[model samples]
Target: MMRSILERASHWLALVCRVIAGVALIAMLGVTIVDVATRYLDRLSDGAVAVTLLGSVELVSYLMLCSLLAAMAANVEKSQVVVEAFSHGLSPGFKHRLQGVYLLGFAALGLILCLGLVDSAAAAARHGEVTQDLRLPMGPIYTTAAVLSLLLGVRALIHALLGALFGAEGEVSHGE
Candidate 1:
């Protein structure tokens, strides 16, 4: 029952990350489209109007940052790049245990990243940092990144325990 709950929590975190990534991607696309369309508004309106997204680059930067960071949690298991050259003849159970250990290492790395991001966020908040073009406060962005990094760490840990310790991959994935 406990494993099931953790599995569900991991799954939900991934789902939420996916949604955040999608929204960030869409917002970036929208910003790009608007920037392009309004690039020559002064000429298009024959000097009657001058419109352009002044800080579009900065806006897109934050959006892309959020999208990439948000996707990290969801891609923990699916995006593991491995050679697997020496493990050709390994037993299924051994492979499961090996994967679990590898995931633990990933979790540790994620946690380290989370800690660094938290420090960075705190510094950004303390110093009143702002983006160059937009003049937007960076504390919120850094805070969001720190939170997502923590989520990646936790999801990786949960995936390691439930997916490998229980038996196989399907133990953590009962419905989807």
Candidate 2:
């Protein structure tokens, strides 16, 4: 199939998304480190101790987790994972089939997780659950994470279908 502009755009967007997620992950890690260090500093003015730091840590942690899901999806899309060790000896057709099966199972699992969390998150949203200090709505975080995971699942399902149809890795050269 000819690579359309949309496909090319998606490829580039995915790379950018991966980079953004990577940077977010790093920031989250750094924030967490600071939170931990300051908490144990044993030298803070009674009024200088702000509760927002704790909330910031929570926010960063949630962002980190969401970014991780995105990263996994991007990694899977790019065929970054090393799976050749066991399948190297298998014929290409057989290996492709195996990969399709694997991807399908992974997608199924992700769907299950999203389904399980939807109700609990909704309840939290309805009851106005919030962080102890910042009192920010936790519902949005839960909802966003669920949706992102679901999207990732859909992407995996598509990849699996593509792999089964075209062969593993989706690496067909038109000229060759």
Candidate 3:
């Protein structure tokens, strides 16, 4: 069977987001490991060899944000927490529609997040904002976040459409 272009595109984009999330996770781990090591080194030196990673805390914070945001776009559907209690008695078709409606809510939220981030990024750029410790430009980070958030919205919207029009993730709706 041939798959729709939307399905293909969403799959590819989700894979990319997963990769980005993986990289962010690795970077976060490295930063945390180094920061902890520095703490241990400081103790070992007894205040003589005071070495620090300066902005390690700030770096980790941004990395953590990136990790979570990158994972969001790809995993929105997979990560949804369903309270089956209310809908357990409903038919599968009805349940699928309900899930689609739920995803639409998430799509709306993602778009709102994207818009807010875009505004924040523009403001940061205009004000020459920088992170407190690392002095890294805030505009770029916020812009990246905005882009990821947009992807999240788009992905969720597509999934919502598919679920509403068709059925659940793998089930054929009516006659296919």
Best-matching candidate per lDDT: 3
Q: Write one digit per residue (lDDT tens) for candidate 1, span 1-176.
A: 87678767877888999999999999999999999888777678886877888999989988998898889887776655545786778876666666667888878987898888888888988999988988888888888888888878888888788657774543433321
RMSD of 1: 2.7
Return the lDDT, model 1, position 113: 87
| Model 3 residue 154 distance off true place after TM-score fit, in angstroms | 1.1
RMSD of each: 2.7, 4.7, 3.6
Q: Write the per-residue lDDT of candidate 2 for residues 1-176, one digit (tens) a residue.
A: 43243244445545755775787788888878787667655346454755435576566867788788777656554553436777678887666667766788767866876776677689888898886666878787677667756755665666566657656544321210
In model 2, state the lDDT of residue 74: 61
Count of backbone clashes for each model? 0, 0, 0
- What is the Cα-based lDDT of residue 59 in candidate 2? 67
Report residue 47 deviation for candidate 1 (angstroms): 5.3
Pairwise TM-score winner, candidates 2 and 3: 3
Q: In candidate 3, what residue range of length 10 has the lowest lDDT sum?
A: 167-176
lDDT of each residue in 1-176, candidate 3, tens digit only: 22375577678778888898999999999989988988899999997778888898888888888889889897877766557788778887777667777889889988999999999999999999999988889999999899889888988877787668666643222221
Q: Would you list the clashing residue pairs of candidate 2?
A: none
Which numbered prediction scores highest in TM-score against the true structure?
Answer: 3
- TM match of model 3 to true structure: 0.89
Q: What is the TM-score of each candidate against the true structure?
A: 0.87, 0.70, 0.89
Ranking by TM-score: 3, 1, 2
